[model samples]
Target: MSGLPERIERGFAAARQIADAVLLEGYVLYPYRASAAKNRLRWQFGVLVPPEYTAQGGEHSHQRTECLMEARDGDRLAVELRFLRVQRRTVEQATAAGFESVERLELADRDLVEWDEGVEERIELLVPVEELAGEGVQRPFRLPGVGETGLVHERDAVVGRVIRRREQVDGLLWLRAEELPGPYRAQRLTVEVENSSAWRPSRHATRDQALPRSLVSAHLLLGLEHGRFLSVTDPPEWARPAVERCRNERTWPVLAGPEGERGVVLSSPIILEDHPRIAPESLGTLYDATEIDEILALRTAALTEEEKREARGTDDRAGAVIDLAESMPPEVLDRLHGAIRGLREATGSTALGRPEQPWWDPGDDPGVDPERDRVLVDGHQVGAGSRVLLRPGRRRTDAQDLFLDGRTGIVEAVLHDLDGSVHLAVTVEDDPGADLWRAQGRFRYFQPDEVTPLDGTAPVEGTAALDGAAPVEGP
Candidate 1:
């Protein structure tokens, strides 16, 4: 655990954190449902659909992305591209007999007709074109189509074709550029990735469905040598200025805009991370933690009762699936618990009652009393010098950097804001170099809701706890 594996594990953890942030960028829950009034804007990042195609319904089009690449003379490089393919399909609902009348039928009186829903088809091809060679003479290379096999379900069917191969396809696209043409210089390269799919009318179909489109969460992964990975979710320091400017203006100059403008405005960051080496070998692999997580999450959610039982009983991947199913969000867990309770009630098996400690229970202490502007630890008040834990489930942000979720810290001061909001200034125990007392100290102010007081035998330090005999207030 203390060697290359450890480093790789840490890298994956960091990558996962960045991916999680990107995963929640547009929507909060699973299924990535689109709401016109909510998720109104699509193609937030890495949008490549041409304006003409977009104007013509954008059902079928090619999307490409350009990035800056650097390599020494004659150095080989590998590039991996990862993105999500979102498909839309029509679902038909059945009504009970005589329920499709002037008046709406009651829940008990109406029965929904069940029909098989076909899976939407989306095809993606990522090609690293020669635009990176700096206007040099072209050398053509042809590659044969790759064939793959998988379960073909007519119901909810999804088919992917690459270079006209009809088969199930992996989501990742890779391209390798061998024998670099230049030495240790920055070069701009373009990756031409295309999505192709068509919607066909069906007997129960209400409207013509659009072809499947790609949704990039801006979580591209670049795998460099020596187990190092560059996460494109957050741009590197050098690219931050440009990314920030684009983010501030809510537009980007990459994809064509609605009015046929050369660039599309962005509402989020266009992250980029470059490798330190010059023209390293392109691994030609795609690594996306969030995409993997999403697949597992959806699979777990779609499991039937019998399948779930089998999963719980089986070993290998089936058992792992059960574990993933149990790892849903707190809100989802609560809903599941309510559903289980309802099922138990319907079966008249109240003998088990409710478990002594339900899975969704958050335990006794509620952390903060907003009205009192004070911290409570298991029903006890917290004072200066008392150790405490930051509340979990907070959205990771700049202001929350000083305190990590579940990390314990020492309370340096407790103060009130102008609006009567309580703010706790704490110095993280692990961060000994933190300047807790200064105005610009490493100590950060947190809302009472952000921290939970921990039990301590020592008495409160009182006014002496103040960094300079004056209490720091306000953000």
Candidate 2:
């Protein structure tokens, strides 16, 4: 394999070429939207690269990104290349856009809903509306009305201009409404139902039935600081009555709080016959009093450093950096951190679409590979190392790198095939430690003698391959 300097040299060469063909081409900046909290307003600086520079994706061929405005109105601001895709636009249009086309990108500051936290803990739940029969209300359809907040249900409710008739032959009518232009043109009006069929006629008794209970529903817009809790239901059927009643009144069932209420307006108002609504039996009405405290207790429980790391979006690098930082002397730590930051910036300059990895130069070593002798996995022999074949990175479907730890004989076999290719079958032992380094995949082949000496000694030539193709795909 080529040495570190060679790999980095090639990577930088490619990045420069891409920069010349794309980044220097320039782009245009346009105002988008501002955050409700007024912390930032989004803007887009569109850059049109030549047809040759477009990434291989559909409409995504053109990249789109959001940037924070430095001032209410300013021409100059830091930008990052966010959306990098190819769009079919004339070169003249692109050149006319008066914005620096170099490094036109920015990082997103939004936190997505924690859907990946766990299946048991949902970020949001929908308590769909349903119809319930009432006195003299044979065709009673609930209308929440546009721009109302919270759920509201009245047993014998009457709403004029109910555009949607309930599909149920004998079930209660369900009507949904969205914001529309009013007669005055400036006011918002309630239009027809969104999807009337989504509401079903359900009874309170069965497990899947929508219970018969008066309810007030609210569609909450949650912000970062606030949270609401929905306790696990002992008997899920308790939710039915609330859902049914919400349908009668046209309110969305919701868990609300001060935090979730931040900078967010409810889609509709919740109006039950009574000012304060009663909890349904399905929600374990009694537990409602204690559920909040229990949730608070869970939140207050002590957590390990690892758990805290997860909360901050730290992965393997975080632990490594922390562990390494803690061991360094105070003065050395500062220097090392600064150096690390610089390294990160330099490496980031050669990322995807950038010319970090350059075209192959025939004059370079072109490297050499030793014939594989024996292959073993978990102690049992698989085949001769020469019999294994591997196609490392650069190719679309090829494996990148391979790593093997000393313990547990993680890599038992390294095989070479008749076609002069190689493969390594690994067998990992007991569960690995959080700080453990498992076997790494290998792209280029090297002699064992060439690698053993370089492990801890002074860095040698071709050490870049030992570091697993850094500049090619640096962190």
Candidate 3:
């Protein structure tokens, strides 16, 4: 086993927001209540079942995560194992003799029913990288069962009670690292999580019956102290072969945190980009990450008083979503309609495409011809059908521009934005999908200074523009 690190929670906190969204995704569907059919199969992703259940033909019992990390001396690794524990809530009607379990219990203020809820659990395995590199780490852990009761009282007399219980679950975690033979000192790290629960159900047990001994929404968040983790999704050329041999099972690792930061890796059940983020306009989780906030909130707002009452009695989180929809100010809720971000360059010189005219009238922007318009690049006129060399500026370029450093391309159009700035749209000459890109009007954008004319040709006059061209993809 490897040595443990002193600081544990620092790395986990940095990547907590997106991690939480992943944890609660699909927790409950729209119209959150037991009556909704989608609420029955709630825990959908990253479910690790007990080995005994798999022996009788069920879901898989284990998952493995493998990723690459660049490290040096004084580097430490912390593995955060996070999952949800199944909890069964049963409403029992208080009787003169003893409490008898009932399908539904009605109280003065609310109603109650039997439902499944998840309790979050996280086990941290903090180890020094030096010791991990020397030998592997093995740790045994358990997700203890819970039992409790909450009394429902009306006018000082107990009417009913809710009993919550769950079966005990056990598991084992394994970690190891192997050094890659390359100029860059990189380590191939492997972490495996297995469900070793001894509990088993009857031969014909249903999925809900087998879920008590399973790990729901299981995932691993790995953090580094003084090292950097490579983007497995978009690794460099030299590390592609090693990355191909990583052998990640049931989950994919992505570079997490704010844009250029690479100290954390979130190995999730769903595939995601380098840095997945929640939209700024979102208020909070409504349990369905796949749906837009405006639509979900509107649906919640449209529910009847009886529906809202049932939803409020469903769960605490569901009630909170209901409150957000019903209590939000008009200005705050309007923000959910839309938001525009990352405007590259502004467009100028379009009398018809003005701030007052609507393009549907067929009189807007008659002079705006994307293909016929000409822009000055390095003091040379370049437009459609002209060849130019791509010279993406160093400090002004994004990570994607690194690949287009010295590539030559043909000008597809000269686009203008509503912000009163001009941009040039071009297609790479060597790209096999260049024709398809032009046909679809999806061209890469760049500033006038980023390109140089390759051929000496006169500027194009307004014959006609690229027919039905969309806006530039990006700059």
The model with the greatest lDDT is 3
Candidate 2, 1-84: lDDT as tens digits: 122233222332333222221221112110101112221211112221212222221101121111111111111111111112
Best by TM-score: 3
Q: Candidate 1, residue 340: CA error in Å?
A: 36
Per-candidate Cα lDDT values, in order, are 0.36, 0.23, 0.81
Candidate ranking under TM-score, highest first, comes to 3, 1, 2
Candidate 3 stretches with Cα past 4 Å from truth are 1-10, 55-57, 345-475
lDDT accuracy of residue 298 in candidate 1 = 53
Rank the models by lDDT, top first: 3, 1, 2
What is the model-wide C-alpha lDDT for candidate 3?
A: 0.81
Count of residue pairs whose backbone atoms collide, per candidate: 17, 67, 5
The superposed Cα distance between candidate 2 and the true structure at residue 108, in angstroms, equals 31
What value of lDDT does candidate 2 attain over all alpha carbons?
Answer: 0.23
My TM-score estimates for the predictions, one after another, are 0.30, 0.16, 0.72
lDDT score of residue 341 within candidate 2 = 21
lDDT of 1 by residue, 1-475 (tens): 1222332334334443333344334332222222213233344444332223444453323433333344334333333233333322222222343112111111221211111111222222222334234442222222222333222123364221111122222232323322223443334333334333222334343212221223344233322213111122354566444334321121111211122211111112343232111111211111222234444455566866545543332212333445556566655544433222233333343357643543233235244322233344344455467678876335546755743777888776666545645567777777756654534654666665666656644333453232212222221
Query: Where is the poorest 10-residue window by lDDT in model 2?
Result: 113-122
Q: What's the CA error at residue 201 for candidate 1, in Å? A: 12
